[model samples]
Target: MLIVGEIHTALLPHSRPLTPEEARGALALAVGETVVQWARPVPHTASPTLLHGVDCRLPLGPKPGNRHADDAAGGSSVRAVGTVCSRAVLTGGHLLQGSAWTAVAPPQQPRRMPWSYYLARPGTLETIGNFEARRLAEGYLLADGQGKGLARKVRHDGGTALLDAAAIARHSVHDVLSRPVLDQRPPIKTGSTRLRWAAIADPGEGRAVAFRLVGNDRRRMSLVTGLVEPEQIAAAAEDLAVHDWLLSAVAARIALAKIGEDPRHTLRTLRPVVDHLLHLWSAGARTSRDLEFMWDSLERRPGLTRQWTTMTERVRSQIDYGAADLAAKMLDMMEERQKQTGGAGEPHYR
Candidate 1:
């Protein structure tokens, strides 16, 4: 629903009378197929005024601040305000004897940058359409031309004025209801998980780097992080080669960022890390197999078993700490698991 504020009333065009159909199309209705009802005030017996004006409070959706942070930052606090103008015509109960009018001005247009050069940018049209659709649906009516004649007709009809008033109200309500409401929610991918990564260089002039693996939750982030180690970092520096699936995913993210003008280039530059992860997984598998043989030989001893468990956990922890990408950690875990299980099965890398 649209809750408009600051209505301006103006003189109706003195030239022509509006048809009933035109009047009916002027009333604003909320989204959906719901019918709108008008509440006219009782005429004052002592006052001889033919026209009475009122402000009808309509329920608008959530506050602008709840939807955008910029609105809150701008110091524009939205309050519950009457959006629709309600003007009543009172004439001996027959015809509307008095006239009332309200005017809605056009909305201001946003600033635009001149496109001196034509560039094929993704999501450009989609973004513009979304913005325009929202504005068209939510804007208020300023001056509906139907009010002039409807007011006069009721005044001429005498005591049956209430019926005329009802007709006019219906016409006004319909106009408000015709606009379309568009869905604003973005599309989501189901079943598949979204993984993101960031790398921060040390402020000091050093080769030290810190990496974070982000996912839907901290546990998932940590799980992905647990797949690599510092020793693996040197291998990554040599020649990082990633799987086709992971490489394509990272490439898509980079393309999206470039189109959106996102300043963060960390994701775009981290392709090498993925390559490094694939290399480590391949190298680690061989070492892991030898470790598994030693591990199985000492499995009968409880002390040795506990020691192996502690050592493996320590290795996993170090990998989580050193890896820049969560997917890389996952790849390491897959390789390790394969080796531990006697290379009998493949991991679910996807």
Candidate 2:
């Protein structure tokens, strides 16, 4: 079995973080399932899973404009029939994420199955016609340059089709963000991080997760692991996306600080990094123990927490310097006034 999903991470378009009660109202996407929240490590909330039925052609290539060899290898068109699972998540009660994931399993028979059969599986997708799960996984991780301002390039090749997991995630985000519950004004301006991941389930094999960060535009994460439920993979992906967003968000703030600029303005930009973002860097704190090694591997090299700590200290230093400068200037102004008045009795400097 193979599972593919995309996560869209963005700042909750609000000036303040939502309280636990408020977060509940924000994530109520279904009738029966309740939104789950965790308060200690960090304030986090997750909506109930929602299912979307898709009977579209599975995309054939790794990119929109490129063609996968498998497209021609199969010799005929392939269609996918199944449900894509989507949910909304909030971390630190401030970062909002829209995640959509689905499992792909071979059909009981060669031909397409009834929609009822697929629906019964909920978050699973059944393959129709001819499809290669490995090829589909490769294509998903490839960056096709899809996002704001970038035009999607379409491939007219006969071999492959496109799956709209990102679209499903975006729609979920739009639905919840539109609610009046949100403050609707962002505290800091930053770009969203898009993560598309695919996992191959092999219970006997050892568990492993590998990720390739494709430029700054998108990330492609592929996992080959021992038998694990689809929900577990989705949880690991969600946790990965959240920390990636925090690292990116804080890094952007550090770049924008411009130490050469006025200290006060620098402090203004860095305040949110310290108050809201710093505490959110506890990676793998909520991930499954099976996947903890993935986080460990990443931390050993790029060292996300280390980067965050360095950036945070820089911001704090700038703030301290700015505060001292402002105090000194105020004292100078008072002394100048006294000198101009020759310390006259109109009023004495306190």
Give the alpha-carbon lDDT of every model: 0.24, 0.77
Per model, state how many residue pairs clash: 30, 7
Tens-digit per-residue lDDT, 1-73, candidate 2: 8898898999999898899998899889887888888986888898988888877555444334556554423
Model 1 TM-score, 2 decimals = 0.14
Off by over 4 Å in 2: 60-77, 129-131, 143-161, 344-350
Model 1 residue 56 lDDT score: 18
Q: Which numbered prediction scores highest in lDDT against the true structure?
A: 2
lDDT of 1: 0.24
TM-score of each: 0.14, 0.87
Winner by TM-score: 2
